[model samples]
Target: MKQQYTHTKLIELISNGGEDQENAIRWIYSKSGWVSIVKKMIRNLGGSNHDAEDIVQDGLINFIMDVQKGKIQKIEGANAYFIRSCKNNWLNNFNRKLKAREIIDREFNKEETSINEEKIFVSKEIWEHLDRLLEQIGRKCKEVLKLWSMGYSHEEIAKLINYENANVSKKTKSLCIEKLKNMGLNPDDWKY
Candidate 1:
């Protein structure tokens, strides 16, 4: 069994671009390098195989993008970084799914309650405003902001969104946030 993942090989493959990058990806998959890493992460995190695969893909994308942008200079402990990114991506995805379920449950329960019509109308209006603002932002920017709002760290956001690094993610997030601020929505407006 190949114990060491050839980080230099992968980086070189990615840097070369075109068919070389594709071949490198194929090599990784063929060796089950990322898959094994993700499986271990999933097991550690108590996630399923499917979740592990998803996380692995997310990490691979991040690594490839970073290499292509010449953002990652050091390959020392690259495997550790890959594992960390995969775990973070899995956690973020899991949290979002769990939150979606909570929202659905709340909505179902609310339908059974005798809530005042006025309050419902106000809540709907607020959601609509949020939706409109989100629509105004580009899809990528909206996703980045939403992930940030969900309390994902800069590193996690970079992995999830395929930014070159946390610094890049922070800068892009700042730009998106400024756009939102300019549109008149302040942090104080957030209920939670």
Candidate 2:
């Protein structure tokens, strides 16, 4: 039987907070165990090897930070959590780019047509509200919704957003939508 490295062991090493913890992290990745897990996650998310590598590096950094801060108790489920964080971080970057593109599109369109001051004010207000709503959501939830809005397939989003799978993504999305609904913003009212 293959030896299983539990997250608890990693977490314990991390929480110990010393040179030993650093060495443990190095060993985990250097030994190729964590790298393989990260690669699998990256492939599931439809990301390139480079991107996956970056995410894994980021995840490790985050894990270290959390451990140092006494925020993470153990590594019990750290792998899943770390993967989720990496996916959310990546999606957040992607969403920012998407928003920037939309803003550029609007600006170009505005230049092409005459916009009334009242309409511009209303648009600004709507955007402000949307921004507030985005801020209200937890980071993971916001990332998931943003990826869904970007038209990523459920399977891709599951990998990117750290849901169990595509089906979980769908259910989670519905929950997110419900949260939006409770905010009194009907999807039908917004002309996307």
Candidate 3:
């Protein structure tokens, strides 16, 4: 257990900027185990330990800088302010990622993502075109699309492609689609 500080005392110590500042930062990090509390909150909010670590680091830096720069003169509590900053950071990061994914989905989904009902990919001519396109991309691009079109789970694609995890496989699949789109893939062009 660590001791808590009054906002005035914390502000003074941090403003002075020396050994006092280091100790003040330490107190803020460990007082009543607030760092663990922050990390737990992040995990509860669907973030990973790595994300928690990043948020905590950024929060500490911003808090210290703000206090030193006279940006935070009064506060109900330093802990609340610090945690709120981190929560906002996480939410912002999550939204940015979500928006990026939406953009990728829109770009990759201009046409129907699925092929013919038989899964032979419309016709043999399309297969040849796809083969050429896949060659331009990479061998794994073809397999990723094939397995994905066959309804194979991302976890399955990860194992098949030696990716570290499902998330990596999913990102790879997105990249493949982006590459194909860059190569001017139009399903309508392959239609007889």
Candidate 4:
């Protein structure tokens, strides 16, 4: 497709800055087909229109800077060069994301194994602490906590312990947990 502004005209306008630069950019956005081309390329890469817009904006800014810096003076192929810059941005971003995903996957495997081992250790410690704590707490508190730790629901515990309601059972469990904390047992050391 034809560009609204010639390579020389756009570069010269961009280099002049101020109104000329603004017009050059406005022409690129409103008249040139380059933006659509860039957006299509990005969409083909599984990117959203927003991503295309951002990358294209960055590419335009960089192109204008290059012109102002004398790095793109009288360039006959600025259009191709500008489009290439956008493609490079997309490629760099894609590579960075791929690297991040790879790192997370690598760490997750080791982390998952360590997390499993930690869970086992913490579970054992909590049960041992509970056993010793049961001896010190009230009988009702002991039974409530044991059943709670064993995965019994508040409703079930209420029925078993003859509490007025599930709320009562839940409150009793919270109180028992608080007692464990007061006795220097740190009930939440591993979140029982």
Candidate 2 TM-score versus the reference = 0.48
Q: Give per-residue lDDT, candidate 4, residue 169.
A: 92
Model 1 poorest ten-residue lDDT run: 112-121
For all candidates in order, the CA lDDT equals 0.73, 0.70, 0.79, 0.80
97-192 per-residue lDDT for model 3 (tens digits): 665565558657773343332233234566787778878987787888877875679999999789899998899889999999988787665544
The window of 10 residues in a row where model 2 has the poorest summed lDDT is 112-121
lDDT winner between 1 and 3, please give it: 3
Report RMSD (Å) for each prediction in the order shown.
Answer: 10.6, 14.7, 18.7, 23.3
TM-scores for every predicted model: 0.51, 0.48, 0.53, 0.54
By TM-score, the better pick of 1 and 2 is: 1
Model 4 Cα lDDT, one tens digit per residue, 14-42: 87778999999998876787889999999
Best by lDDT: 4
Per-residue CA lDDT of candidate 2, range 90-184, in tens?
77656655665665677777744234433333554676777787677678777778777656789999997667899988888888878877876
> Model 2 Cα RMSD, Å?
14.7
| Distance from true location, Cα of 11 in model 2, Å | 2.1
Off by over 4 Å in 1: 1-6, 111-192
lDDT of 2: 0.70
